[model samples]
Target: MVDCPHLRSIAPMKTSYLALFYRSWPRLASKALQATTANLPNSFAIGLFCVAALCAAPVPLKAQDQDPFYYEIRPLFENGEQLGQVYRFRNVGLIQCLNGDLLAFVEARHDVSDHSEKDVLMRRSKDRGTTWGPYEAVWGHLEEDHAGWKDPAPVVDKATGRLFYFMNTNESEKRLFYMTSDDSGYTWSDPIRIPDSLLRPEWKRWRNNPGPAIQLKVGKYKHRMLIPGHIVTHEDRHFSVVWYSDDHGESWQVSETAVQGSDEVSIIELSDGRVLMNIRSHGELDPGLDPAYRNFMYSDNGGESWYGLETKRDLPWESGHGSLAKMELGDGNLLFAIHPLVVKRKDLTCFVSYDEGKTWPYKKLLHEIGGYSSTIVLDNYDIAMSHNHGFRGEHGIDFVRFNLSWLTDGKEHANPTVQPLPQAPESKATDRAIWREDFELADRTILDGGSTAWKILGASNAPIGAAVSNGKFRTSDAGGEIVWQTGRIDIGDAKRISIAVDAIKIGKFNNSDSLRIYYRLGDGDEKLIESLSFSSDPQEDFETYRIRKHDINVSGNQQAQVIIRSRINGDDKTLYWDRVEVARAE
Candidate 1:
């Protein structure tokens, strides 16, 4: 522990109503007046107000409770990066102990270029969010290779009062590994790996970047805590597989996909026991089209499953990233701070997720920024997020809380009501548990901002290669070992167009392959669009990520029954997907 000298004092409760207004005076005004007044004794009553007004009169703020939602980023380190020098990077988990010391678990990323190795870094904030201590390395790896640890998830078990860290094994395709700190982060425990027969080497390689993010923090006011993290990557495709632990880090299991194409996952619990999970998807490829952006998920049953949370019950994320938080507001409205980004341009946009991530209609474009961000709700309830300032280059993280009024430049009712979900077949994909279910949504979405309609088939618990696999598409069982097949879906339209495909590789392989998106339009020509490229990258494990693509585009609307086929030349693997969103553009 270190010595500290920061002090904050608030006035004792006032029994009289007008006294409340006097206590709420602006700090500067209160300080100036206190020197002259508040010293004299009998400035006593509201009726004696004139005696108090003998020197100066007091004013009151009307409708203070109805104040608009706002937040100003506060740095945890007084000698922060800019302030001076203290803990550099602050990851997801931020916890305050009973003894009055605060702590944060940060992905000690000295390099944010998607190039260097990342590890778990730490800092102690003794004075709440005001300042931090000297930096400490919880899991820093000296070697700069993909084999180093990344994303460290820390949790202080309420049951054990013990601090446990669930991080990834040393390799990119590593399994879950953990360690414990008994002496309140001042000590040690060798990393221990958790084994589940369901883990597949190839699949592990596919999700090599383990965030190991999040450390369970004390809830606003509850016994239950939450532990969360994300499977990360630098690859073009944005995919996030979030995992959560209810009782600290005793054990871990798969949570849900915060967003299909998310990378960083962080969870924060509100005072009301509401758990909000934010996943940063890649908006770099396409904000609306690409999944990278800030996306959200909520869990009412703690962490069982978020497929039914009320968060998106109102606003389904079209896309965006980082995380969100709720604050004790002047008005009854809660405050949220998020670092937003657009996938295609790598542009940044900041906004507010007001109603438990249900909708962010109250948004202000806080610049086109990108990078990891996690916010906190201090005792006074100031909300802020830390992230790289630029949208294109590598920049160290910084935090600041700005208001919604600042973001929208005072705009009103920003998030307009969207088009009502079109009436269609109620989705049957998520209804089952043990097995997978696949149902195609009959309606066509106007994607890429236009005309062509791409059919989408969403699946849940559905085994990919296990049910049907060709050289192109595959699915596996829990172990990611099962492989099945359905050769190809042949289309009939061939005349005024052509057929083509890229490639698909659920798990890595030695083969260079491609799979074409094949289809037959209504009473028209058979066509195929091949644009996927399967990778030929060398693998440290049994898998590889290949980019394969067929070079063809078919006539509009003539595309029928989209199908993918591939020839790996030697190995056999099943390709799987939670859902298939087919966009057959013109």
Candidate 2:
């Protein structure tokens, strides 16, 4: 058993230094002038006294003024240590059972990578997460079976008091499995596979998305159960879709591809019975989409069809899994989102949206370092959440229970107005050029997935034989091949970063071919900053190259690298780049 600690005590609340400086300086200066006149010469004594008074001024009370509430973050899985053995945990799922029990599940792996063999494990908390019990093996390794199980998406059908644990086996075929538990989570039915006819014939590899499943609670399709899923196309592309069950768990139906070039979706029902699906767009594969944010779509007719695919920039995320839930707390219903709010998989923050998914004003950092989180509204209306707390690949799945008051920082009754995001600082003429390349140096060798100064990666992301030809970086001869990756160039910190490159298309270029610019900060994942697509007609003249430039605000990162890539469609089409540069703006 792990000891749970209240968040208020463990983490010191941050305060506004500028507010305190402005409020206390006047009083301190008056006191300093009064004490200095009698002690020494007015000018020197006042200067000495003012320095002392400034240091002695009392700190602000904003942190103490905040209304404190009870919250606990309990460690369930730490560094892959459980059941007297070591194994990593990932792909979290949580659900409140009909009988008020909180059931949590995750994929326990021998290692953190996806290809590692793993088991699906569960834990239960009957007393509203005050205490959690030992691990229960729902599906896992057998002597004859070594196939891995991943992505535990659990849903509770409140009307029938049945719990559905949805998951999939990770093998070459990738089969879907489901189990029902009537007695809360005490026991589960034998793992059963969905029939082949229910799944589309083209979906050779279908997997359950990591998060909680939703059961619609309003309108004509009330009580409809929907869980997000995605299928890998024959060309290795992914599309977000939904698996819905109208007749409870007895039968299930698949929905049309809601968003193409997307994966790992989570669905929430908004007011007026519209189902909104938040998606993880395929950034590297999907041209023109900023990978820093997630995409969204809505379905008015339950999960049968979806429309209006749009990107929500308010959700600050970088291609990691996120969970969404609508909280019916107190006077209004608030939409709750939990995901990595930074470019890296750190700062797993909770965002509260008053106007559905339009804007999020209130937020709380649940964990400073987190990954792949799932949230569920508890029986008492508090949020019971779980996430992978370890940095990078190490596994530390911890659970936390918090309420609306704690999440909103005691501003539960405050006006629910949309908070405008701060605009980027304007650039000035004083901005400096940080890094630039003209490919003017002697030719250098480029290798696939190598440490060479330059590399041309093929579809497999491994370096193929290539060289910087004629003072320019050139992509592979094989066009329209899946993905083409170029080597990285380092750029220092900046308040604003701009990436520019001169490019020319050669041979027969298709409309689908695109050039993308990405940036990486430290050890974090590469984020897609901007993308440029080639024109329908290929340019064969030497003077036809055009400058493609993109600017973005990245204030505090100490180091960054610019990653350039190209997605082409057919052979013989290639893109050439020269005069690449990265600069800092005012």
Candidate 3:
């Protein structure tokens, strides 16, 4: 071990309330200030007051009592008991060292941008991340590097007991760099620019993965250090790639392009000595694909080649980084994934898969608002996910500690199977029309004078490839699936509800192809109203078919929503909806 001036060591404590608040000030600021201060003139003062109140209160560390415990590493501003950093923290990179200590790093930035001025800051947790030491700048600290630094992807070399850090800098152009720490992150070497041979000069832009890299322990290329990253082509195409170093970070080689139309990937070595890369689908960048779903690819020969590229429909990923982790359970294995659940980067949820990323049957919400996450399973088996705690990472980065028992509610879903679609009950005789969408005129507004209107599903507050034109509504042409949902409608005096849609299907259909309808009463869950198989229809081009359900249960004077969605198994398919109606039945 070498002594360095940047490192500051703090004594380990079983539980320290002050220590927790000092580091978790950003968490308090986001959670408390949003709830308490609405008309308050100065939110910054209110935030400080809340911090002081929380630290003074005798709050116990509920590491054992509460599952999925949360704590922030750095705060945006200096609070009553904390010293704020020079810049806010984002893009967290975390890993568990060989000595059982946790090394965490974040991008200290004035704003959250790829080219913003940034510095890499780090903190250590000696007590399994119960508490962490203060922040010390690893790069862009002592030197005045005007250009920005980004994406701290750290890896621990088990054979040499050395820690290798990989990051990118835009000093002149986007370039990759590395630094090393021989003593469990106590000291570090100066930043060394990665040679053009490893990064590939032809690639216009290359970025390191925001999460921690992996070192293979039980594979054909055991002890190989692989870092997941993405390079952009001059044509604006994004592809995921891996850089592997077999000699313990001595030399690195760039693997073949992992997958196209994807970016910001996280990788984990599977049980059968293969690497699985979880990709963030950016189909919008490539017009041929569908966006907003988590994609996967396998590297059977240890990052040398990639194949089996497919999208997991169960995981509805919007547009951000996610963490993929493998959990070992009594002779069997389960893969856990952490990402945002909705169309936006909010509601950070954890999805658990029992059959090696084929399907995800178990999931739980870890945080309300989240962005850009990294996860690691500790030696004791508890999972810690470090992520940006804000909606779009405007606040800062925070890590939540949880376990499988907490995520799955202490239950094991062995041999989990996908639940069959719910069948629509037989319809009774019905009469009056409560709501209808004839698609005669286009209404782009989400709501038209308090009455909900039919709108296509979208991301980042903009509609996708769907439109209402020429007396019909057309689904996206990019394939996969497109969902059309109506806003809440008040079903006044109607005891039972029914929905019907008349549409013409285009392109070939498969056995797995389907058109589904769902209804949600009040604030309850969305229940499936009907599922119609396209294969059952007669083979006729441009033939119009009507799908209807007439016996949906509903209460009077309660708000309800009607949803119509379509999925194509393997080919491109579009739905031209001519008419849709939600009627009242007696």
Candidate 4:
């Protein structure tokens, strides 16, 4: 640990907070300040205030003061490149065997689509994820019978030390089946069908989207293994349920519907013995047209019944699959690995919650361009993450090995030579009376008399991809917002203000969802300036939007700045802004 000269004079709490601030201050201070302060005046007083606030913030343990950890990234499987025969690898499931070996399982698709013919593939890592054995087809179809084995969910029996890998076969008769691995994933037993009586008659036709299973470590249901499963009831309806095996997978009983209009759930037993299930909502069940955040429920009866269903507004996520696991370390912290965007599958971030899954105050971005992910805690309190990343021309399922120190202490642990991907440039307005921003610059700073960068607000998440690219500044997919300051522009002499820009939907266009714009003058509250609703254009393309002088209301204000916001409403529609021109009394 680095010796701190000021430790002697500082209090215990202040010392810890200051140590973390000092370690990350030099490198991350600029970005952190930019993200937190956008509305306040850019003066030395505000700068000092921000610094003081940061110093007083609660700090995690510093990396130098903590035990050393290791991090490594390796491709486990890739699309079109695993074996000569397998074309796609998806639906990752990881488990540590009884013999301390790591078993990585995935769906080997004959084609890229989910409905295509698939099989269960496995690889064993004996040395704590340092290396892997060759691929093994655990289950597959010999002929084109249109039957496929998908969604592998594995749970180890603590009492028997036997691994049970559960899966569902989608054929003329959809059925739940499982295999047994006695020798640490070296070999497996033949698939045995789960009793049809375990499922309700109305749930027979449901398709299972499997996720991680956990054994309750505490409470009355100790050692009970619960496998999280989801099924799509209709095109726009889905629900999450669990299968409980009290006898170590000898027989199983399905739980009642835990959450409605939700799918792809991950459950974790909290320190209080309550099981919390995080689910992906389908939006059809909520009043909101598109639900961007995850829905959660708690079970007190060992996965038998669920209650306390609520939307996690703090955790902003897209309508995609994510993984959650409980860290066996201090306070039994919960770690969530998800695509951090609202409507797109990107920015794979790991969030840590100290008080179970209630509030996630710590986060780390693991991959810039990511898809479905599964997380597993290693034997040594380290973390193993497997996810699909398509960045730097590497498109496949990659594994990342890291520890709590690397995640919380802001230390570089793995492959220090490899630099992280550069962040997208911010969008800043020019300082001229007739200011114009084409968003052609790679920096997010506005080129007024003094350059000022746009700051993120309301949410800590950044834009999904390319905030400023191809001569445009794109809005985020998840209804996040950003603000840019114009400094002290003298527009008091001018009668009216006008703005013109080109806008287009990034993906599919929806008329109900539109980009909203607002403006504030000299520290006043932000007022609505323009609302550029999507037009009924048959073709999905860009259209010019002009805010005339009458639409702009800048009365008795000498200095003003613009605030651009949009709620994509869970649709992956990105609003692109280009050729933004602001004028006075034009």
Tell me which of candidates 1 and 2 scores higher on lDDT: 2
Tell me the TM-score of model 3. 0.57
Q: After superposition, which runs of candidate 4 have C-alpha atoms over 4 Å from their true positions? A: 1-69, 81-84, 144-146, 234-236, 287-290, 330-334, 391-394, 410-586
Residue range 1-586, candidate 3, lDDT tens digits: 1223221122112122444655567566666766766666686767766776765464533334333322223332221222343576678888887777788887777555666887788888886677778876676642223446788899888777788898886543346777888777887655655656665656777778888999886857998899998888777788888888988776788889866687889999887888999988664344433566787889988887788877787888776899888766556778888998765688787788878887886666666688888888766566777888676566677767654544554454222221121232333445678888776565333323335376666333234445664456755343456677888887887888778777655555657666787878888888886676665432222224556777777755477888877765443555566557788867
Predict model 3's lDDT versus the native: 0.68
**Decreasing lDDT order of the candidates:** 3, 2, 4, 1
- Candidate 2 lDDT over 452-535, as tens digits, reads 244454555323323455556666444334333435544554667776666655556556777776677657788876666554
lDDT of 1 at 23: 37
After superposition, the stretches of candidate 2 with alpha carbons farther than 4 Å from their true spots are 1-67, 283-288, 391-393, 413-586
Mark the 10 consecutive residues where model 4 has the least summed lDDT.
415-424
Candidate 1 positional error at 41, Å = 25
- Candidate 3 worst ten-residue window by lDDT: 6-15
Which is the leading candidate under TM-score? 2
How does each model score on lDDT? Answer: 0.41, 0.68, 0.68, 0.63
lDDT of 1: 0.41
- The model with the greatest lDDT is 3
Clash counts for the predictions, in order: 77, 4, 0, 2
